[model samples]
Target: MAEVRTVAIVEDDPIIGASLAQRFAIEGITTQWWRSGEEALAGFARHRPQVVVCDIRLPDLDGESLFGRSTRLLGPVPFLFITAFGDIEQAVRLVRAGA
Candidate 1:
């Protein structure tokens, strides 16, 4: 059987984070939900999820920086940014920059 992919979700909103985590759980995928970028970064070394779902507006560290740091640590894993702000320009920039 193929290995199940692990996914890390970095979102400040408890409701959304929990919902996303639950969704992954229902799909039988491993998930780690973090409320802050710092928390995610700290645990990333141990978890090393193949995919990361991050919110752009975090408490201490923003998603852009988090994505960059994650890439540096794990060598460019897939990152899916989620934000209510919905800034297309910024998203384009992030994607162009390899986030």
Candidate 2:
């Protein structure tokens, strides 16, 4: 089994990001919490985390766009996307796009 070393948290909400990061820390997984999609992209280029926990609506770019761009850069890293505002159409689109 491969150990999960790092997780990237891309969320605009401070509390959510901090909570996730704390949990990962407890499990001995290093986490990088990025507040916006743009910042996350930069971090992804540098850190290349084993997994990503992201919020769908970011200040700069939406989660789907970020995922698309990230895939080009990092190639199929796992992303667990979350959103407070649920949109069925958007969800379906994401599913179709391999989200």
Candidate 3:
């Protein structure tokens, strides 16, 4: 919200990813957009984003797993999970687990 330092977007959808990147750029929020779980992991470690915007279903690692790994590595940084999928169960589990 308030001038985010940096954000990592782990979204495989090209259109969504690009649109988010553009919007963040407009707000002067630096972003690193990764298309897969593997890429997101690598880039997350490298960039150390202040926040992460990730999709629930990824090509390699899936969002729940990625969120777990990211929390361990990043020390509880904020993560926002975006999903177009209709799987409400998984999302609810994550939310209840305090993800």
Candidate 4:
């Protein structure tokens, strides 16, 4: 079977990003952490992660926008989005729209 090569974490919160990275590492998943949407885009140009975990409230671009752009670059990869409790509605909408 083919291995799951990389998991990308796109979060502005340093703590969250580090914590998630550590957890994925423990599971033996190669991870790439991008602090912003722009950084993720640049990285995607080089290598598309097998999975992308992104924060909805990104600094440069929102999660939905990032998801759209990322899909354009690398095609439909699995994406998991995180957001604050207050933004649950938006998150739901995005998910329903296939984020």
The C-alpha lDDT values of all candidates are 0.90, 0.90, 0.87, 0.90
- Tens digits of per-residue lDDT, candidate 3, 1-99, equal 555789999999999999999999999898999999889888877789888899988889889899888888888788899987837788688888667
Give stretches of model 1 more than 4 Å off. Answer: 1-4
Stretches > 4 Å off in candidate 3 = 1-3
Tens digits of lDDT, candidate 2, 1-99: 678999999999988988999999999999999999999999887889998888999999999999899989999888888988859998898778777
Task: Write the residue-wise lDDT of candidate 1 on 70-93 in tens digits.
Answer: 898888788999998868899889
Q: What overall lDDT, based on C-alpha atoms, would model 1 receive against the true structure? A: 0.90
Rank candidates by lDDT, best first. 1, 2, 4, 3
Clashes of each: 0, 0, 0, 0
| Candidate 2 Cα deviation (angstroms), residue 24 | 0.9
Worst 10 residues of 3 by lDDT: 83-92
Q: Which stretches of candidate 2 lie over 4 Å from their true place?
A: none
Candidate 4, residues 46-85: lDDT per residue as tens digits? 9879889999888999889999999889988889988774
